[model samples]
Target chain A: MRFLTLVLRSLFRSKRRTFLTVLSLSVSVFLIALLQSLLGTMDALTTSTGSGTRFVVQDKASFTNVIPQAYTNFLRQQPEVERFTVLQWFGGEYKDPKNFFANFGVDPESYLQVYREEANLPSIPLEQVRDFLRDGNGCMVGRALADKFGWKVGDVVPLKSSIFNLTVRLNIRIIFAGLRKSDEMVLAFNIKQLQEAVPWMKGRVGAITVRAKNPADIPRLCERIDHHFANSAQETLSITENAFNLNMMKLLGDYSTMVHSISAAVLVAILIVTANTMAMAIRERTTQISTMRALGFRSGQILSLLMAEGLLLSLLGSGLGIALAMGVASAAAKVAGQIIPWMADFIITPETLLLCVLITLALGLLSTFIPAYRASRRPITEGLRAL
Target chain B: MDDVSVRLRNLAKSYWRGSLEIPVLTGIDLEIPRGGYYALMGPSGSGKTTLLNLIAGIDRPSGGELEVCGHSLNGLNDDELAGWRSRNVGFIFQNYNLVPVLNAYENVELPLLLQDLGRAERRERVLHALSLVNLTDRMRNYPRQLSGGQEQRVAIARAIVHDPELIVADEPTGALDAKNAEEALILLEHLNQELGKTIVLVTHDPKAASHARFQIHLEKGVLDRTVEVHDRPVLPRLLT
Candidate 1:
């Protein structure tokens, strides 16, 4: 503790160099934190416990291929299948193409039953839910979506579908709040209204969501469903909801690898910059180090002092980076929610923070070790004569 | 050996420049009794500073036996020698060598920290040492804030604060003005006589050498001769 002030004072001896090095380090750390948080958010979507008991059945060719509506009848007959819903991705634009949000056409009744945990209907009045279920043109917008567009219970929302090339006008009957902010970025309307209005979407849906009676039965149920559709013309791919989201992520093409690569590069750059800074600082202190040795301070003590200075510099930079990352993440959650609803839950987890801190510590030690050791081991007479 | 603060016999040191060995000191035999004050004087390449470093245990001799305060430095490892030096030898440098970031008190407190002394005892010793050099009022001032003379005084205080048995100085007043140099010399004399610390100083100045009880001159890598001073200057009683 007593040596802390000495270490700190020595670090700031060249204020401009120290400040620039720390700034560069903080920016790199911030970039790393954001990238790690993105990977974490994606992982959360595919591994969430809530998705364990649910299965998604899509056309075997691709998720974009529509599955026949008859698949829902086959799913209902299975004893392990507790409830199911037909979900169609209604890629629609509100007012402008830039104003985008997740809008899905779903069976109003079964959608509520299958996703009761996520939808959280208790927050809304009972009368609004009845109106939403009974009225063919009635739709339920999540609280976040509603707040974003200044939508009220009685407001009529006009959505122009990019896929169907049709415009549908519906009255909002329920404004639902979900357990998570990401869930509250969606808007669900009656699938029947979309089917009746569009000729191509009459007897097909993008996917079917099946809730299992027992989570333990999910694997068996998926295998049975896939087997049933094995020889059919439009074969189905039945997988857990988590695996379905993972498949969707895969369609985006090795993004995890890209993020990981970019993260590694950033770490290397920061390590080089920090190492150079520490080398310069140690080089300048050669004479002082010799004087300390002459005053009976051991080589190990000098090495430790130099290492402490490096560690403090890295930790302070990382701490500031983490704080900046949190603030940016909060703002990004709102902005990204409009473009990618799943990203609304983007957050820097404690584990990610802990991992970053550990990495920073390793970086500190690794960047300064060789230089500090070399400086400490230099000939005392030679160093004393350096000045 | 019991009465000697430093003893050297056939001590030698050499440096390697690629493939060639350039000897700095060779076949040197010397001794200084306890509480003795001596100055080493020579030309630029006389190796007086190198010899001082050897006696201070900061440098190892290439050959022969060297002992300071009764500790044989030949067989000790670097860390072991450091421990021995911490207990027995203090050092004053030409550049004042005080850590620029540390205040006067902290600089003096550094050597004590190497010992098992508690904070109060370290503070007491540092205060006494600073008072001996008459710089107690500048305890909180950093090295940059003090003049060249005052900075050397802080260096002197740092040297004596740990109460080592011997104090080795290399051109201690080389950077100071005439007035400051005289004051530093008087302080060195006080530490030698009053505190009973054996002092070995290396310098090129005749006036500084005249203040020592004896002067040892060195030629190229060898001891030339020794001269004893009969009328060393009497310092002011203020140091008492």
Candidate 2:
């Protein structure tokens, strides 16, 4: 504890150098934090608890290809399947191309039953559900989507569909909130209205969501469902909801590998910069180190002091970097939520913070070990003669 | 133990310049009794500083039986020697060698920190040592803020704060002006006589050498002779 002040004072002997090194380190750490958080957010979608019991059945060729709506009857007859719904990606633009959110055409009744845990609408009265089921043009919007467009109950929302080249208008009957922030970025309408309106989409859907009676039955059921449709004209692929979301992320093209590679690169760059800075600082203190040795301070003690300085410098820089990363992550969540609705809950998790701290500590030790050891191990006479 | 602070017999040191072995000290024999004050005077490259460093246990002798404060330095490893030096020897350098980042008090507190002393006890000893050097008022001033003499005095305080049995000073006042040099010499004399410290000083200045009770001269890495100074009177009694 007594040596702390000495180490700190020595570290700042060249204030400009120390400050610049710290600034560079902080910037690198901030970038690493962001990259790691991005990966963590993507991973969250695949690991979500609500996705455990759900399965997605899509065309075996590709998820983009539509599967027959007739497959729903076969899926409902399976004992492992409890309830299921048709979910068609509307791919609709609100007012402008930039104003985009996930708008899905779903069976209003079964959609609510399968996603009850994900979409929290406990406060919604039964009258709204009845109105949504009875009225063919009725729809339900999440609170976030409603707030975004100043939409209220009975407000007619006009959506321009890019896929079908059709304009669909529907009256909102329910403004729902969700158990999680990401869930509130969706707009679900009755698929019957879409089917009646579009001639080609009449007997097909983008995907079918099957809720398994038991989460443990998912693997077997998915395999069974895929085998059932293997010989059909339009073969089907059935996967756990988590795997489905992962496949969706795969469309963004190996982003996990890209983010991790960029993160590793950032770490290596900061390590070199920090190591160089530490080397320069230790070099300048060669004479002082010798004097301390002559004063009966052991080489190990001197080495520890230098290491402590490096560690402290890194921790300080990382602390500021963590704060900056959190602020930027919050802003990014808001902006990214508009473009990628599922990413509305993106955040820098505590696990990433812990991981970053460990990385910083390792970096500190790695960066300082060779230089500090070399400086400490030099003969006392040689060090004394330096300068 | 021969009641001596430092004892050497046939002590020799050499340096290797690439493949060549260059002898610095050869066939040196010396003894300075406990509480004795001695000055080593020699020309440049005469190995006086090298001898001082060896005596302080900061450098190892190439060959010899070297003992300071009753510890045989030859058998001790580097870490053992460091521990022995911390407990038994204090050092003052020509450049004042006080850590530039530390103020006088903190600098004086350095050696004591190597001990098992508590913070309060260390503080008390540091203050007392600074007081002995008459630099207590300047304890908070860093080495850069001090004049040459004041810095040397701070260095002296640092050297004695641990109350080591021996003090090895290499040209203690070499960087000081005449007035400061005289003050430093007086402080050394007081430390040797009043506090019963054994001081081994290496210097080129005749006036600085005059403050010691005896002088040893080194020539070409060999002990030339020893001279006893009769002009000054020893103190009547040890201060403590």
Candidate 3:
């Protein structure tokens, strides 16, 4: 404890050099935190959905291929299927093409039933649900989506779909709060409105999402649904919600590999830079170190002091860098969430934070060990002779 | 306490450069009794500093017996030597060697930090050391903030702060002006005569050596002469 003052004072001896080193470290650490968090968020997308009971039924050819709404008849026959909804993506823009968000044509009652837990349907007033079920033109907007567009109950929001040559004037019937962050960034309207507006879409939907009566029944239900449509004109593929999201990510190429590669490369670069800085710092203190040795500081003591300084430096930089990353991530989630609903799910989890801290400590020890050890072991007389 | 403060029996030291063995001091035998004030005088490469380092336990003899302050230095390892030095020896260098980042008081308190002392005791000793150097008012001044003479005085205080029995100074006033050098020499003289400290000084200046009771001269790593100064008078103590 008494030696702490000396170690601290030594660090500030060259203020500019120390500040620049810390700044560079902070920037590198910030980048690593953000990148790691991105990977962590993508991982959570597959792992952390509220319940494992939900699965999606899409065309085996590709999820982009539309399937017939008549498949709900077969789904109703299965006792393991509690409820199901026809969902179609309405690729729409509000006013300008830039003001994009996820809007879906869904059977309101069945959607409210199957997604009751995720969308917090029980929390909404009974009147809002009734209005959504009775009016084909009415819609239920998520809390975040309503707040983003300054929408409220009774506000008529118009959306123009680019895929289908039709426009929708949807009356906001309810604003629902969801358990997951991404769930609160969607607007689901009654599919009857889409079917009536676009005649050819009357019996078709992008996908059929089913909620299993029991979680243990999901695998069997998936097999039964796929087998029912095996020889039909449009074959069906049944997968859990998690596998669907994973497939979506796969379309963006091997992002996990690319992200990990970038992170590793950045880590190595920072390690080199930090090690070089530590070496230079120790080199500049050659004489003082010898004087300390002469004053009876043991070699191990000297090494410990230098290691503490290195740890403090790395911790300071990493702490600030992580805080910076959190702030940036929060701001990005809000801004990007308005344009893409999934961006709202972006988060830096506690596990990710712990991993970053561990990396910082490892970096500190690895960067300072060689230089501090060498300096401590140098012959005392040789160092004393240094000017 | 042993009557002899330092004893060397056929001490030899060598430096190795790759496969070459360069001898610095060869078969040197010397001793200084307790409370003796001796100056080592020699020209360049005469190994005066090397001998001083060996006596201070900062360096080891290649093949000889060396002892200081009753401890046989050759038997101790590097860490043990450092512990021995902290307890028995104080060192002053030509450049003062005060850590630039620490203030006068902090610098003086450095050696005491190695000991198991409480904060109050450490502070008391640091203040007393600074006061002895007549720099208590400048205790907060860093080395860079003080003059060369003041810095050397602070270094002197640091060396003596832990109350070691022997002080080894190598050209302690080499960087000082005449007035400052004389003042520093007088301080050393006071430390030897009034405080009963055994002092070993290494210097090239005759005037500095004259302040010591005896001068040991070396030529080419070998002792040439040892002379006792007869004309010098016992100086009055200049520090309280």
Candidate 4:
């Protein structure tokens, strides 16, 4: 305790320098936590919807490609496919070009039933759905996207399509905010509206998503779906949700490689910064450390005191950074909610928090190893003479 | 009762600066009896500090058997020697050697902290020791805030706080002004006469040496002469 008093006194003697070091540490940790949280939120969005029984049948060339609209009709005949729906990636923007959200042209009935667990689309009364679907351009929007623009049930919103140069006048009859993950500012307009709107709308649809009763039936169902479309002009590539997310991760330039490389850089930088602090503290305390030893404090006490200082500082810095991260993530969720509604689900799991703390302690240990050893093995006389 | 608190026979200390065998204490033979105040006076490089160091267990002898408080100086390890020194010998260096971070009270209480005493007991002992040096009022002041005399008194308080059998002072008054030096010398004499704590002090000032019940002067690593109170009248007599 007395040793800690000594350590604290020495550090606070130059209060500005210590505060600056702590501030630098906080900034470093805050940035690291922010980047990691973004990645974490992305992963959560991907993994939460993963089910082996559900396979997305998209064009082998690209996910955005339109298979013949006739293919969905042909694939419905397959016994292995329990239920299927077309997932159209309707690229559209709301308000200004800066405002972004996913708009998908989907088969509203089958899509809602298939992904009822993940749909953030509001539960419109069957009468309301019929009323909303009464017109071809009538759309059901995500409530989060609705709430973003202060939209209510009767708001007529203008959505401009990026893929097709058509301006969509969507009469928002009902908002379908179902699950937390799928809440976005997307308009699930009638496929007929999409077919009539686009120039290349001749018997074309985006993709078919198939769900089987048994997970074991997925691969055979996929093969069956592909076999049915084998003779068509457009071929199909069927992949499970996990595989789809994995492919998305791969789309970010090899998930394991990039995350590993970036993590290594971050960790190295943290180590260097923390070690520099320890070194400076040790340098200043050369005499006091010797004095402690001369006062019958064991070598272990000196080492423990130095390590404790490093650990305490780092833990506090990291702790504050993480707290700030949660706050920033929540505020960002409101802003990003317009674009990626699922981003609000950025979560810090216990495993992740434990990992963060472990990183802090590890950095503490790693940075202080040399400084503590150097301080401990130092001769009392020489250390005293240094001051 | 055995009066000898320290005994050194044929003690020699040498330093190897690169290639040179620079001998500091050459063949020193000395004895310090318990409860007696003694001063070791010498010029620079005359082995006064070296001999004091060996007696205090701060340094090891290069060649020869030296013993303090019945422990074989050659046999004890560094840690054991430190514990042994803590239990037996208190130290007052030229710079006082008080931990600058601690106030006078904390500094006085340091050595006793090594013991297994409770905080209240430690406080009592520390206060008692400070009272003997007449520094109880200055207990809260840090070393920097205290005058040289008071700092030395606090150092003295720290030394005797644990009630060690012997106190070793190395040029205790060297850094003090004449008044502070004389004040420190009076405290040392009081500690010896009243508390009966054995002190092996090293100094160069004749006035400081005169306060000791025994004075041993060294020249060129050799003990020149041992003088008693009756044999010296060169300075003010504390007893007179």
User: Which one wins on DockQ?
Assistant: 3
| Residue A292 C-alpha lDDT in model 1 | 87
**i-RMSD per candidate, Å:** 1.1, 0.9, 0.8, 2.8
Which ten residues in a row are the worst by lDDT in model 1 chain B?
B231-240
Please provide, for model 4 over A313-364, each residue's C-alpha lDDT reduced to its tens digit, 9 standing for 90 to 100.
7787678767876678778777666566566565555555666777777888
Best by the lDDT measure: 1
For each candidate, the alpha-carbon lDDT, in order, equals: 0.90, 0.89, 0.88, 0.75
Lowest-lDDT window of 10 residues in candidate 4 chain B? B231-240
Model 1 clash pairs are none
- Residues B1-240, candidate 1, lDDT per residue (tens digit)? 499989999999999999999999999999999999999999999999999999999999999899889989999998998888888988899999889889999999988888998889888999999999889999999998999999999999999888899999999999999999999999899888888899999999999999899999999989999999999897766655
What's the ranking of the predictions by lDDT, best on top? 1, 2, 3, 4
Best by TM-score: 3
My TM-score estimates for the predictions, one after another, are 0.92, 0.92, 0.96, 0.87
Over the stretch A228-339, how does candidate 1's per-residue lDDT look in tens digits? 9999999999889998989889888887998999999999999999999999899988988998888888999899999999999999888888988888988999898768
Model 1 per-residue lDDT at B91: 89
Please provide, for model 3 over A1-387, each residue's C-alpha lDDT reduced to its tens digit, 9 standing for 90 to 100.
Answer: 898898899887888888887887778778888888887777767765544888999999998889999999999999998888889999877887887888899999989987787679889999999998898889998898888889999999999998997789999999999887778888899888888788778799999999888989999999988999999999999999888888888888888999889989988998999999999999888988998899888899899999998998888878987888899889878887677677788777787778778888899899999999999999999999988
Residues B87-160 of candidate 2 have per-residue lDDT tens digits of: 88888888888889899999999998889999999999999998888888999999889999999999999999
For model 4 the TM-score comes to 0.87
**TM-score (C-alpha, index-matched) for candidate 1:** 0.92
- What's the CA error at residue A321 for candidate 2, in Å? 1.0
